[model samples]
Target: MNTVPWLTILLIVPAAGAVVVAALPRRHATLAKQLTLAITLAVLVLAVLATFAYDPDKAGFQFGQSYDWISTFGISYSVGADGISLVLMLLAALLVPVVVLSSWDEVDGGGAGGGRIPAPTATPDATGGTPGGSAGGPGPAGDVGEIGAAGEIGGVGGVGGIGGVGGGSGGTAVALAAPAPAPARPATVPPVETRGEAETHGRRSVPAFFALLLALEAGMIGVFAATDVFLFYVFFEAMLIPMYFLIGSYGPVTEQAQRSYAAVKFLVYSLLGGLLMLAAVIGLYVVSADNLGHGTFDFATLRQMEITPGVQKLLFLGFFVAFAIKAPLFPFHTWLPDAGAQSPTGGAVLLVGVLDKVGTFGLIRYCIPLFPDAADYFAPMVLGLAVVGIFYGALLAIGQRDMKRLVAYTSLAHFGFIALGLFAFTSQAGTGAVLYMVNHGLSTGLLFLVVGFLVTRRGTRDVGAYGGLAKVTPVLAGVFLIAGLSSLALPGTNSFVSEFLVLVGTFTANKPLAIVATCGIVLAAVYVLYLYQRTMTGPVVHEENRVLHDLGLREKIVVAPMVALIVALGVYPKPLLDIIRPTVTATYADIGKSDPAPTHPAAAHPGAAHPGAAHPGAAHPGATHPVATQPGGHS
Candidate 1:
């Protein structure tokens, strides 16, 4: 018994922090921001310690914690991590503090509504006197939603969302031109009475955005950490709620429709998958109850139950639907580009970086072991789809005008390689797929953050809208360039190492598929360089860009760690591969026992019917009499 339940503490602390922030008084906004920052930083430190404390030499789930919550129903509160889960968990923890601090000024602003308050105002009384003298308007940094939308109003929002600007009036002009109606003046009642309270209330609600994001973090971590099958399903469905709110409430106005549509699509797809998996889980429990003597939803217990081959296929399909929808694999991946393009960069970072890994992770952790026969039967088709996704995603990314969507599509291509490596069933491929998860999070997350910062400065997500940005903001352009190169898997970047391993292992398993996938790498270079050319290499576009500042101190801080990780992992990836190899080997061994037998008697039990062969009973004493290692023969 491991006395310290570090995993549980890791989860509970964040949930508690979110609750504290959500309940904080409006007057204590600064305190709320600081407290939330402190909590997120604390979680990050623990996650690091958890990584250090993790005994890679140990065989299975370490830091295991379990408690029966509904024993009668075979349900329990459980959390644990293997190498894969630990890596993803650490990524989540690492990003949370950065996200919090990046938005600190916005979420913790004074009552004047500056710094991310879109509709900031200072109210006046009956005499038109300022309630608080000279409350400066929100600076160039508007609300995240407002700033993210920038210049896409006509095409993105159908022109309704962009309030007209009175030229040459600066911030005050834009503020005065807002679409809201003027206050109804009364001789007896002051005009300030009408607008002041409304404005104040709006300012107080900014913290809710942070609360929503924190809640999303909690749900995402739980999904990665869940141990029991039913518990996993529960956390799986719970994630959509917070993500739904994150997009619908705090999301950018220009992409509002696209964001809402993507969220609903995600919800519907995920729900259908969940329901199918739920049915399969129940069916498995019923079969276990009949044969294994009692029902249980514990993954470990379920793993040992001897399910029939046909039944395993059905169960596998149910789980595959859920994971595929989450993975957004090839044909099922339509929702990703839209969501990634429309979501705030934070949302997109987590979406592409961490959340997508859950899908591929499920294939390794659950599907293959739980239904080995089906996995073997379906291997070729899965491999084909992975190859298809690679070429298809890269080809589409080459045509993208929206910078964010281009990044999203590139991820699709990257995931395609990962999926291919995984189902290839080679140990090296599997290890590479696992490592790809961590590397993708680092590289893609950095790319999205850097892109968001550029969009903030340029006021557009259009790749063509930017040019010669390196000349204007050298530091930012350099960060963007490095991030793009990492995305392209250039030599000495983390993605390069993982992707190379995947291609190498995949080639060993499926030569033609690997060859086709190599084409995707070429396409990656084309689009990455093309994107950089469009955004950073040409003549400077509008005069507005001439004086744009370079990467700010906080922005640099947010990105530096990710850059270091990418470079470090690229230079030396052996440590991650070493940790993953043992587990991958064990998983394959567990499932390798499910290989099917031949139908013909002579072929099925070739050794059994041969003359002078030793009795099969001599091989296994525990098996009833003599269980046949040979196919289609009774012991």
Candidate 2:
């Protein structure tokens, strides 16, 4: 079944895992978690195979499977993977397993983190992960939280219960107890986790927690994989439910009011956006029916319809506002900070890393392609707002004391950059924007995981509470620094390449805007380095931080893939770029734009006698706009 419908299986596997986890008893919470993790990792395997199996040289929508769901209305269970969707699907699949492993101790509390191990100051604490595949012992990262300490603060969570479980009315549901022992470690190494010290710890609703996480994973994959316009909308709105529950029921209970408010705010904003899109959907159907004698919501079919610029503009706004809310651009970004504060770390990782991408993805996949005129009309306005968001988000992030909220705001900045690359409409810019999505997911997800570790160990997400952390938890400090560098688009990191392409692309389109946006990069470095300096570099004045342990084996495993990708993509990004270029070329064709030629300093002046004779105004003379290919053949 190599030729089987892999995209459908990619969707169904996590869904099946969620159902299985839901069916299991709370007493089997450990087993349910293990099973769910295995299924997610297995999906990762599938994604890797799909990537290799794909013939990157020739691209369109590969692995396409369309079937009639509503024959009368022209909607169907249509799904496919192109270079663009494939990378995102891989991102969604990759993160679930890492989040599972990183939060393993928090959820199950199988052992005391630092009670059995020597502190980093006393001796090297190698109780956890090595650099790569192994979640080796918390090697020099430090001896973090002591046994029986409160882990990540719960707006809706508690030390005594896993799911804050309630005994069921029908007979009696099984109550979750202790975390099961992890798989046996090599005998040469000392037992870093002292289970006896952590026997009283861990959450009680393990089965329920895994079920919710798996459900969210499934929704994310479906959103990226759906090809039909109607199917895409269904997945778009459906992904929000698990997130709502995760925030409302899984955060620190002390901040229950804040968590509840955040959840409600998120729900209200998302619902408002969804309703607008729903109205636009009906309008599209009606318009298509009048023009083509049948109602249709096929993305390809709608692209071919000769809708008037007026109608296209109206439909575009409905979709754009929804996407903008999802993107959480400057004026629309107020809801994100609250939600980030209240969400569980894993939930936050998925929220900022993957779910937010759906908005930008919608812009690339639907809004622009289907409404080229509207997209062109709005390009200047959108680009203007995007530049505003970049500066606005950076300034706010620099001023924030809360770690989670700071990370959330940075995402706003990154999304603004992605939006800029897209509206510039150059192939280089488009390719870079798509690559930015994948790289941003890796770097930001790592930052959240590290912050989660700090919050759980210290009972605070406030930056003011931390000082001289690098002296205590060196490895964590290092990880945080790397993430910061990536955030600020430091040279030799994944983000720099994408950001460079965006600047180059924007310059050809709008010189003044490009110059303005470039200043945002300077602001990015300011916030990133300032946050690091305040938290990790000062004297270790706090008594509680002195004993903090470095990364454990489990935590190392969580970061290895992310670290590898950051460097891997930085050095050679061809694999992902190859996958992204074909679809980007197609997008350009849909919008009627040409790849602007590269300009060199010597050849840039209009009167200069150079081979390219490059003019700042248009495509190079006598040369075809290489729409479906890269400059040097493969980026």
Candidate 3:
């Protein structure tokens, strides 16, 4: 059982596959892609099987394994999962295959409008395929349109592909509180000639692209499963390399803008965060050495020592800032939009969906538990930032031009909600926070993946260029709608459950913050629906949009599982909730907080007469009356 080393296998499988793919001959790219697929799928399978091996009843780490990796440094290779980590781990395992499938055609230069790092240079026509269409300039003949509900696509980002998804041309266009008038037509979309549907131009580089994907997967899994602080830092830092390459190469054809800037920006931000964390790590080690007689980076060992409040706060900032930047919380969120906008769909998928979550995860799994006093002390300030991020991100999303960037901004808002729940210091809120991370990954991943599909067809990421896309691509539009609905946390979608729990849980602990955070949901609805309406609804503004293909078999295969999970988790979240609740309760104990009881009117007014007193023997909700005192004063 314990001898099986399941977690180790999960880490090694994809990592080993990456090496194998890298070694394969470049000419055999198709074969490399196949091999990479098989390997990723295998890892996904193992992660699933590993789930069965997990015990929900175990409130502490499960399937624990440790080995002395660097004994002199007091470092060890320790790996395990609890309810919180398990859900996130499963989310990672689930997304990799889907990401692979979604990218199958995209990498080959299919219908992406724009949002890639540059593969090898294709000609202008090869780039856009239109004679006059320069990289950043407008195309001569292509139907450039406007996207977004308000007036033109100027204020909001280019979301112009709508009036087809149920937003009719007349009044519906202005329904989302558009203070401006709808322009007669979409703005000029660059005339990038889309390669016909059957095209397969970039097949040669498939292997290299997929190899990087596998590497990223391995890093993601390792980061979440890591139990030792030093080991966690290793994986945390290791993931950046693959992502850097993914962003630098194999990206969308932005007209003239180079993905190099985005890639470098992402790297610098990440490295800065890592440096901060490394300092904290060294500090933690030194403290342990001075007090415990040995320096150790084991999460368990670190928690055993009682750090002073001052030192805890200082260490907490070092770690918190690292996680915050990684979380890309409001002020630190500048890099994400650029990365999301410039990186290719597959790269963006892992980048936004799974990779960024490392920030939030670290806060819960490391920072708070290791520095409970600091976590409690900074709770109010953190909660304020979370609320501000929620509103701020949604507003920015509502104004984005690129679909990728819009989705990216929305994540900023969602992350705010997740952070709020975690810092609120209640079991329900914290559990909801963990659940939100899982659900956000799924829902947002779906959104990004669908946007990738549209970009593929249009050869442009401009929303305005697409009008009545639903008419031409029904299934694609439907998928977009569902994904959008999920993003808005619709009642029947998985996001709703988590959002509700966070708000409810936060309400019990911090009513004012919870109330303010609730506004995020409303803004979420506005931006989500507006994006969908602008892109998928209305009349077909562009004749070019009319001929685009619908979601292909591969694309459907990519999206189906995510959609299933969204609805399935929405209907009944117990399985996930069951796995999450115990670990969350444990986290509560780690941070020294209790789940506050929901306020009751009766409890609030002990002096009031119990209604049952007037109907002592009648049917009642509580079925009790103040028989002892006749005024609900039983005591």
Candidate 4:
């Protein structure tokens, strides 16, 4: 009944901003970037205000607004925020601005006056020569013994000269031989002046990139705030367009073909999942019609429907598969590595840090609450898959060479933990799962941003490419270590609290699985420390690494808040837990489940008075009088 339409405004601001930014002249690229950052910041402020307005004591969705959109079909334009949705909305808003700041230099042509700046190439060594050369001249050329070899000589050595023996006059021999053959330009390549235009011709414009980012922000907010099932689906699919372009056209990879392949793979997997979910959505509508005498896609109404277990199982598979694919759990996780590795840094932050969370959110929001019976039936199988993903992702992460892919795999493992908590059917576990989602976004987002900073300097993702980076970029190394430690759920970090809660809750229900999952913690430490040791420690072997600069002003600005939050939340989690716990309890209550009670061996003895038992005649352990429950009093 809230009249402000807070969720709608949240959706419109960014969506409207995307259109305006996209329509700007190409020369206004800097304006576009600045404007996009401002808009995201505004959204963050609004999200915070909304959180302040939300009442944790409330039992239902807040800031809710609804209107019948398709009366005949029972669909509505509805939106609201619950505790889970509010936190996630805040998370998405928080990261988008950080991503923009981190990507200031990564996006091509974001310079002043919106002019196209050429992408950073390998740094020239001292004496004004490429890294390939030892001295100031061109790299050493291939030896030519005969006239035929001379033709090959022209193409052998790098810029400066062909068959250059050293820094001496020999470096210029190839240049004088044949004028360097005009560098043998590709037939399809455009002239230098027009190359930027060509790259931006179809879908690679700088304005488009910023526009897509804003649009993506809108979509992410919409997904979390939406209350109508069909409306959720719309936002779910709409976000993919921007992500596709972000991955394919604007990725950091130099090879357009590789970016395109990764983009296509991501698109294909998502579309398949979407198709399955679409069928399930329609199935829900049909089932609703059969029961209620009309079809409806209203989530609240749908949750109230009494679904038969058999049909619930069918619908559950459809939704579960789609969400699992989104979660990219184990077998369906192949697309993520390529996509994450190929995406632009800002895009990657949103990809793993926010977008991938939709799957787990859907499981909590729709799969469990709407189909509680089916969820209970399938909990065991899902838990097994989650456990498998934990180890599978951890093992793969330990073996990855690409830093981006390694981070992506770590997310897969973390998702397993989130999934396990959700299925554990306890309030503590569910609350921890929700908290885990937020912490993962903060910690992993920091990890991705830091990696992007490193890649910006080193120009490579290979772990072996770096050694003793801490020697030169000590601040950067320090930040990277903190991020890695957080990822491994180190004590006194935010992840450790949520992770601990998950294990403790799971142990109460399923001891063996909880114990097995504990091993993933060790594996997390192994991969995280191994990554840190390989990249930041040891002797500085590469000369390029020696010159690497530490984090600059902007980079520090990007990381400061994240680090503060990670540490702050680790120390005092009571605020977030207070907000999240009530919803988790309500959700379990709706499912007709309660926390499992603990038992002691003494309870098995006959005629034994339990110390904590309430009875009319039971004597207090230390008090002078016997304790008793009043008549008609509830336990």
**lDDT by residue for model 3 over 392-499, one digit each (tens)?**
999999998777889999999999999998998776678788989999999999999888777766666777877788888899899999889999999899998888
| TM-scores of all candidate predictions against the true structure | 0.80, 0.83, 0.82, 0.82
Assess candidate 3 and give its TM-score to the true structure.
0.82
CA RMSD of each candidate after superposition: 10.9, 10.2, 12.7, 9.9
Candidate 1, run of 10 with poorest lDDT: 149-158
Give lDDT tens digits, candidate 4, residues 198-287: 112121356788899999999999999988999999898898999998998777423456778999999999999999999999999999
For the record, the alpha-carbon RMSD of candidate 2 to the native fold, in angstroms, is 10.2
Residue-pair clashes, model 2: 41
Once model 4 is optimally superposed onto the true structure by TM-score, how far is the C-alpha of residue 478 displaced, in angstroms?
Answer: 0.9
Q: After superposition, how far is residue 469 of candidate 3 from its true place, in Å?
A: 1.5
Q: Could you tell me the C-alpha RMSD of candidate 4 in Å?
A: 9.9
Cα error of candidate 4 at position 539, Å: 1.0
Question: Could you tell me how far off, in angstroms, the CA of residue 152 lies in candidate 4 after the best superposition?
Answer: 26
Between candidates 2 and 4, the one scoring higher on lDDT is 4
The reply for model 1, stretches above 4 Å from the true place, is: 105-204, 593-635
